[model samples]
Structure formats: structure tokens, C-alpha cells
Target: MITVSNLTKRYGSVHALGPVDLEIPRGGVTALIGPNGAGKSTMLTIIGRLLSGDSGRVEVGDLDVVTADSRELAKKLAILRQENHFVARLTVRQLVGLGRFPHSRGRMRPDDVEAVDLALEFLDLTPLQDRFLDELSGGQRQRAYVAMVLAQQTDYVLLDEPLNNLDMRHAVTMMRQLRRAADELGRTVVVVVHDVNFAAAYADLVVAMVDGRIAHVGPAREVITPYVLTEVFGTPVDVIEHRDRPVAVYYH
Candidate 1:
């Protein structure tokens, strides 16, 4: 489990994130939902040890994310940031192979190759394996990045807006892949998502963050209501039951 205690951050005077406590369990999909600038990325980045917090403690399983060795943490937790930029051109297979660095240490063994192939297959990128990142469309590139994180074979996976460049079909496919990673592979998946209906459909738990604090944390049914949506987003929302899932609708 990922345990967070009194996590807080500030940008000079502005309070960017909490003194908030949260527990992210293993083997399930927990969707972090909130408006822009809601600090979802902040929490994820801090947990990944890519950024420092003003004050707080974060532990992934038994390892303190802050104190764990960089290579060790990379082996245990894989994070895919929202914005992905490729400086040096790399083929799809090369980028996915990089995920094995924590385990392979730049020496690609047979096991590493197998893992890379699995990740590419998982993201349905086998056909694009030899294609350069710059040659793929946005959604295809996004899938390639996700495959890279998956190849890390970590127990904890943190994805910031995994659906960013995906279209309707790809969005659904990406969420389903995440769901399988949790249910079948026994990996914990934490994602920050903007689409309320997608969160309602795919996530086991929905965490609502607003104004740098956790407004609500519960099952999707409870957090995906019209009242919670309106309260957190300050916009009128209508939620209706559809095939046993809550669907949010909004119209001006």
C-alpha cells in the first residue's frame, strides 16, 4: 500500500498541496479527479520522488519514497508523467527497453527482452515497435510511453492523465489496459483523470481534490455524484445511473 501522511507543499506563499493524508491500496485502480491546478500532479510527483514536498511522509509498501535509493525506487514504482518529450529520437522498442534499466542496468538480457516485448504487446504496439517516437501520432506516442512504464514491472504504477492524447476508442482501451494491470497482474494503479464519466466507469475508488485538499475519497458511486461534482468543480452536473455505473452530464 502507498501511505501518505500530512503531505504539504507551497510555492512561496501559495499553498499548492496538502497537509493531507491518503492511503492508496495495492491491486486496484484509484482515480484522482479534480480541476486544473488541483495538485493531483504534485502529489503523484512527490510520491514518485521526482519533486520534493515542504513537509510530509510517503511510503510505497514498506519503502520510504524519499529515502529509498533512486534505482531501488525505480524498480518498485513506475511513473508516467502527463507531458512527454523525447529529445533524442528512439524507436518504440528502444523506449520500452529503457524501462528495464532499473533491472537490467543497461545490459539487456533475455528476460529484459521478453519483458519489453510483453509491454509492447500489452499496449498493442507490437506493429509499431520499430517506428520512431517522432513518427507516431500523439495517441500512439502516448501509448508507447505507457508501455515503457509497464515494462518497468513495478508493483506501483502512477499515471498522470494517461488519457491525455487518446481519442474515444484509445481512451477506453487505455483505461481497460490499466484495469487489467491491477486486476490480473496485481499491480496498484493510481491515475489522475479529467473525465468524470471515465473515472466513474473504470476506477475502483475516486479521490476528489479541490483547493489543495482532499474533498472526498470513496467508491466511485459516492464521489461521482452530481452534488460532489458540482461542489468540487463549481459547475452544475447531472449524474445518472447507466449500466450500473454513474455517468456525469453537463450542459450550459
Candidate 2:
């Protein structure tokens, strides 16, 4: 389980996050949904140890995120941020190999190779593994980056807006893959999604944030209602049953 206590962040005088407490359980997919500037990214980055909280504590399982060793934390959690900038020219395979650095210490062994191959296969990039990252399309590169994170083989995965650059088909594929990871591999999956319908469809739990705080956290059926969606987004949303699942429709 991930325990966050009184976590807060600030920029100058602006309060970005904080005084927030949450408990994310293990072995299921949880989706964080909210409006822009709702601090969804801030919270995910802090939990993944990509960003520091001004005042708070984060514990992934038994490891203290604020004080744990970098390698140890990497072994326990793998994260994919929204922005990725690769300076050096590297092939897809080389980039995925970096995920094994914590385990292999820069020298990849047979198991590391197998992990990379499996991740590539999982993301349907095995045939393109030899291709340079710059040579791939935007969506392909995004998938490659996610594949790198998955190759880490950690128990906890946090993804911030991973659906960016993905088409509808690939987006669904990604969510299904995440669901499978949680159900089959017993991994904890937390994702930030802009589409409420996707969250309602795949997530076992839905965490709704607004104005830098959690507005609601519950099962998809509970949080995806019209009342909650209208409140969280500050807009009118109609909930309709589609194939036995609640789907939020905002477009008139």
C-alpha cells in the first residue's frame, strides 16, 4: 500500500498541493481524474518520488519515499512522467535497457535482456526495438517510453497522462494492458486520465481531485455519477449506462 500524509507543495506563494492524506491499496488499477491545474500531476509526481513535497510523508509499502535510497526506491516503484526529453540519440532497445539499471547496475545480464524483450513484446514494439527513438512517430515513442517504465518490473507503477499522443485504439489498448498488469501480475497501477469514461471503464477505484485537493475517492460507480462529475469539473455532465458501465457524457 501507498500511504501519503499531509503532503504539500508550493511555488513562491502559490499552493500547488498539500495537507492531503490518501491511502492507495495494492494490486488494482486506480485512476486519478480532474480538471486542469487540479494538482493531479503534482500528486502523482510526488508519490513516484519524481517531485518532492514541501511537508509530508510518502510510504510505498514499507519504504519511506522521502528517505529511501534511489536504487531501492526504483526497484519498488516505476513512474512515467508527462514530459520526456531524450538528448542523446538512442535506440528503443537502449532506452528500455535503462530500466534495468537498478537491477543490473549498467551491466545487463540474461534476465535483464529477457525483461527488455518482454516489455517490448508487451507494448508491441519488439520489431521496432532496433529503431532509433527519433525515427518513431509521436505515439510510437510514447509507447516506447511506457515500455521502458514497464521493463523495470516494479510492483508499483504510476503513470501521469500516459494517454497523450495515443489514438483511441491505442489508448484503450494501454488501459487494458494496465488492467491486466494489475489483475495478472499483482502490480499496483495508478494513472492520471483526462477522460472520465476511460477511468470509469477500467479503474477499480476513481480518485477525483479539484483545486489541489481530493474531491472524491471511491468505486467507479460511486464517483462517476453525474453529480460528482458536475462538481469536480464545474460543468454539466450527464451519466448514461453504456453496456452496463457508467459513461460520462459532457458534450452536448
Candidate 3:
């Protein structure tokens, strides 16, 4: 389980995030949703150890995120941030290999190569693995970055706006893959999504954030209701039931 306690981030006089506490269980997909400046990205980045929290603690399983050795933490958790800047010229394969650095210490073993291959296959990037990152389409590049994170083969996965730039088909495929990863592989999956309907459809749990704090956290059904969603997003959202699931409708 991932435990967060009184986490906070501040920038000058602005409190960007937290004074928040949350518990994420093992082996399920959880989606975090919120409006602009809601601190969703800040919390996700802090949990992933990509950004430092001004105060408070985050522990993934037993590893203390604040002080744990980063190399060791890489073995326990893998994260994909919202912004990825790869100015250096590198092939998709080489970039994916970097995920194995923690386990292989920069010298990839055969198993590590196999892991890279599997991740490429998982993201349907085996065909583009030889291509330079800058040469791929936006969605393809996003898949490649996600594949790199998956190749790390950690127990916990945190993704920030992973569906960005993905077509409908790819986004559906990615969510299904994440579900399978949770159910079949027993990995914990946490994703930040702008589309509440996607979170409604794919996540076992929905964590709604607003104005630097958690507005709601519960099973998908409980949080996806019109009342809760409308309350969280501060807009009237119509809820429609389809195929035994609740889908939020915000468009007029």
C-alpha cells in the first residue's frame, strides 16, 4: 500500500498542494481527477518522487519517498510525468533501456533486453523501437515514454495525464492494458486523467482533487455520481448509466 501523510508543496507565498493524506491500496487502478490549478499534478509528481514536497511524507509500500535511495526507489515504483523533454537524439529502444538502469546498473542484461522488448510489444511499439523519439507522432511518442516506464517492471506505477495526445483507440487500449496489469500482474496503477468518464470506466477507485485538497475518494461508482462530480468540478454533470457503469456527461 502507498501511504501519504500531510503532504504539501509551496511556491513563494502560494500553497501549491497538500496538507493532504491518502492511502492507496495494492493491485488496483486508481484515477485522480481535478480542475485547473487543483494540485493534481503536484500530488502525482510528489508521490512519484519526481518533485519534492515542501513538507510531509509519502511511503510507497515501506520505502520512504522523502529519504530513500533513488536507485532503490526505482525498483519499487515507476512513474511517467506529464512533461518529457528529450533534447538528445536517442532511439526508442535506447530510451526504453534506461528503465532497466536500476536493475542492470546501466549494463543491460539479456533479461533486461527481454523486458524492453516486452514493453515495446505491450505498447505496440516493437515496429517503431528503432525510430528516433523526435521522428514519431505525438501519440506514438507518448506510448514510447509509457513503455519505458513499464519496462522498469516495478510494483507501483504512477502516470500523469498518460492519455494526452492519444487517439480514442489508443486511449482505450492503454486503459485496458492498465486494468490487465492490475488484475493479471498484481501491480498498483494510479493515473491522473482529465476525462472523468475514462476514470469512471477504468478505475476501481476515483480520487477527486480540488483546490489543493482531496474532495472525494471512494469506489468508482460512489465518486462518479452526478452529485459528487458536479460538486467536485463545480459544474453540472449529467450521469448516464450504460452497460452497468456510470458515465459522466459534461458537454451540453
Per-residue CA lDDT of model 2 for 19-99, tens digit only, reads 789999988999999999999999999999988999989999899998999899999999999789958999999999998
Superposing all C-alpha atoms, what RMSD in Å does each candidate have to the true structure?
0.9, 1.0, 1.2
Native-referenced Cα lDDT, model 2: 0.92
Q: In model 2, what is the error at residue 18, expressed in angstroms?
A: 2.1
TM-score of 3: 0.96
lDDT (C-alpha, whole model) for all candidates:
0.93, 0.92, 0.91
Question: What is the lDDT ranking, best to worst?
Answer: 1, 2, 3
Q: Model 3, range 168-245, lDDT digits (tens) per residue? A: 988898898888878876789999999998999999989999999999999999999989889889999999999988
Can you tell me which runs of candidate 3 are displaced by over 4 Å?
none
Give per-residue CA lDDT, model 1, range 6-100, as digits (tens).
99999899889998899988889999999888899999999988889999899998999889888898989999898887499999999999999
Please list all clashing residue pairs in model 3, or write none if there are none.
Answer: none
lDDT, residue 19, candidate 1: 85
What's the CA error at residue 206 for candidate 2, in Å? 0.6
